[model samples]
Target: MNRLFNLVNQQDNRQLLMNTIRNGRVANAYLFHGPEGSGQEGFALEYAAMLNCQSRENQPCGQCPSCHKMKTLEHGNIHLVFPIRTGSLEKNDPPFKNFGPDDMEEIQNCIRKKAENPYEKLCPFDGKHIPINFIREIRRKIYLTAPEPGYKVVIVFDADLMMEPAANAFLKILEEPPDKTLLILTTSNIDAILPTIRSRCQRLHFPALSTTDLGNHLRENGIREDRINLVMRLSGGDVRQAIQLKEADLGRLREMTLEALRMIAIWKIDKVYDLVNRFVTLRKENPDEFDRLMLSISFWFRDAAILKAGKPESDLVHADMQIEIRKFVDYYTELDAFGAYSAVDNCIDLISRNVYINLALVNMFFKIHNRIQPGKSQ
Candidate 1:
């Protein structure tokens, strides 16, 4: 079952789950919570398979009929639930009642991608909430007799997105979870989950993968040897993000960051606005693009700060850009490199929250400059 992805970093979580299977003391429900790209969702799917596997060995042999279905997330007894934009619908209208043909097609595609790689970031149409109708269907299905010989498993991805009605409905299911039925919830934002729900389920925290583990995973994926270190650091211990950086050509993103800094330092409004448009506009269409850019920007300032402290290039994330950083630090002897890092870091958080984008980006100029050239009139 672990073959679906590299969850080696979550060894404790894996052992805990396996011990339950070994001890025949499975919980009625479980919550897999962690940061994005931490393999929470993927692990839920595999655990579901393990519970339903036809083998008597207490683990998925990856060869049974049930295992085959679980591999592609097509099992009859396994219910894969997630948030969707299915507005106002009946309480028992079945899953995806409001979805049209196109929507269904898109969802199937996203599911296939997820089945292939659970960490693959996907959004069919920016799903904002889980409908209560889906919850009713889950309640209905679990109370019925088993359609198959394995335990009924229902997995809800991003369970935090459930609205009030849906959340309450799910709480009831958790309160009296059916026998031979397991419901697993995976969420990146566990704080958003209702504490009532949290108290009922066994909570498992999935920590970020170590750089060494991420590096190994990237190597297996054929990421360039030279880019492995940079990708590992930039991914913040996320394997999916590491792949995204590798595919997006992280070197180009670094160049973009350096260019923006050069333009911002001179306070050229026309050119800066042009660059900002390129950044903000693309960010709306491709968030990973903007994420790469911003993370790269932060690294530039981090390198500058490291250089300012007279540290070795070995300590820099973008050590290859040492020459450019050295000159930048030398020219702006008063540059508050630490302040500059905080500025971009804060901007990243703002943009993620959907704050005023244009102003927020433009302000970075004054903010970074003020740090370097304090008390100077713009």
Candidate 2:
């Protein structure tokens, strides 16, 4: 049996799934919902491989032909689906029409990437929805007889991105899946999924990894020792984000965050303005870095809030900046500290929705400044 999945921290979930498979009572449909990077998709792939493995062992034997194919996502019985830009069709950029040769190639590439690294996040190239056309094709394919003598597994990553039409088209299959078929849907936001779909599937919840687990995983992955601490704190236990941070220019972002906080606390309007301008420029140059900067600011406020609440120092994401956080905490009431945290969160939400970078940063700066002012009440 493959031991790859044992590395994941969700022991209860793993045990339950293994029990069901051993008992030969696998559910027709399952919803794996949790925060992003909490091992939903990884578990889905592992479970799929286990179901189709030919050895009939308690877990997937990595040596079997079925297991080999499943590992590389070449198994005929496994279908992987994810959201794609419906509009890409009009541009002839990996169009969705009839799932043409180009579309098939793109889908295969995506699956291969996932097979290589189950923790890798798959996102639409441009659009937001999993179009009805894709779901329709999946529904048709699911009704067909399995090509081999094992379970057919259809795994949908980010299933919450299904549009209304596509989601409606999927209900029938979810309600009456074919014999020897398993449909697994994964999503970071459960509320975004249809109630009917949620009701039809057995829900499994995944929790964020603990700090110790995350730290160990990073070290084992050969991540630099010096950067591990910062990434660990910034990841909030999300492995994907931690991986991204490995390649990210986090030092610059940390400097910006600290400077912004220092300027805000001192009420240095000119320095804040200059900082916001630099942020706008960074957003134009590399939007991802800009987002990371905003996340850093959020963490800064979070650390201040933790200090204000008289929480243990160990709880701080920026524990290395304990002195600064302590000083910052003295400048605001607990309510204002929390208010600053909320303001940063609001800014992140707006930025995610494609709000103008300069306006969002400027407004966020002012909001944070107000909350952190020495005499502010709320």
- Best model number under lDDT: 1
lDDT by candidate, in order shown: 0.82, 0.78
Write down the worst ten-residue block by lDDT for model 1.
1-10
lDDT of model 1 at position 197? 97
TM-score for each prediction?
0.85, 0.77
| Candidate 2 lDDT by residue in tens digits, 1-378 | 354443457778888898898887899999999998889999998888888777766568888888888878888998888877675343222226646677668766776667777887766364477877777788778799888778899998899999897798789888778888999999999999999999999999999888778888888887766556668766667887787775446666667778777777666677878887887788789877776777777777787777777788776766556787786676454438778888889988987898986788788878877776574543
Query: What would the TM-score be for candidate 1 when compared with the true structure?
Result: 0.85
CA shift at 218, candidate 2, in angstroms?
A: 1.9
Clash totals in order: 0, 0
lDDT of model 2 at position 326: 81
Q: Measured by TM-score, how close is model 2 to the native structure? A: 0.77
CA deviation > 4 Å runs, candidate 2: 4-7, 88-95, 98-106, 224-229, 258-272, 283-288, 298-316, 319-378
lDDT of 1: 0.82
